[model samples]
Target: MDPAAEAARRLEADPSMLLCGPLSVLHAVLDVVVRAYGEAAETVRAALDRLEDRVLAALACRPHRGHPLPGARGP
Candidate 1:
């Protein structure tokens, strides 16, 4: 599954757990910081931040460089 889909599955499977993990510590600190600086916004900026690196690293992809298919062009 794709990263977005996986994340959605995670959120659906266990929302509280997804948001309440150790990552929540950083989120909580951001929440406090936002409140402190009085930033106005509909959603937390952190949510907009891309966690793609961590997410993708967790979901390792299949390597496809060496195993070329039959009739495939060669360099």
Candidate 2:
């Protein structure tokens, strides 16, 4: 089963836990949201790092390399 579904099932098994009032519920949801945001930011950072490494490698290996790379000139 999916992890989200499993979490939902666990929550459903204890419906009373949902009665912890608005503040508690709001905190729980915000905690999850913040954690997910952090995970996403890390994923994006890793991807961008990889892209930067690749671009640097390509530039270093290019023959007749010049400053300011292709298409980087100001209008």
- Which candidate's TM-score is highest? 2
- The number of the candidate with the highest lDDT is 2
Residue 4 lDDT in candidate 1:
44
List model 2 lDDT by residue over 1-75, tens digit each: 344554455457767757776654555556566777898899999999999999999988979744686779755
Candidate 2: residue 38 Cα off by (Å):
0.9
List model 1 lDDT by residue over 1-75, tens digit each.
243444555556656845677675445455555664554353446544556666776667645458778999979
Per-candidate TM equals 0.25, 0.57
Ten-residue stretch with the least lDDT total in model 1: 1-10
Model 2's number of clashes is: 0
Error of 2 at 31 (Å): 0.5
- Residue 24 lDDT in model 1? 52
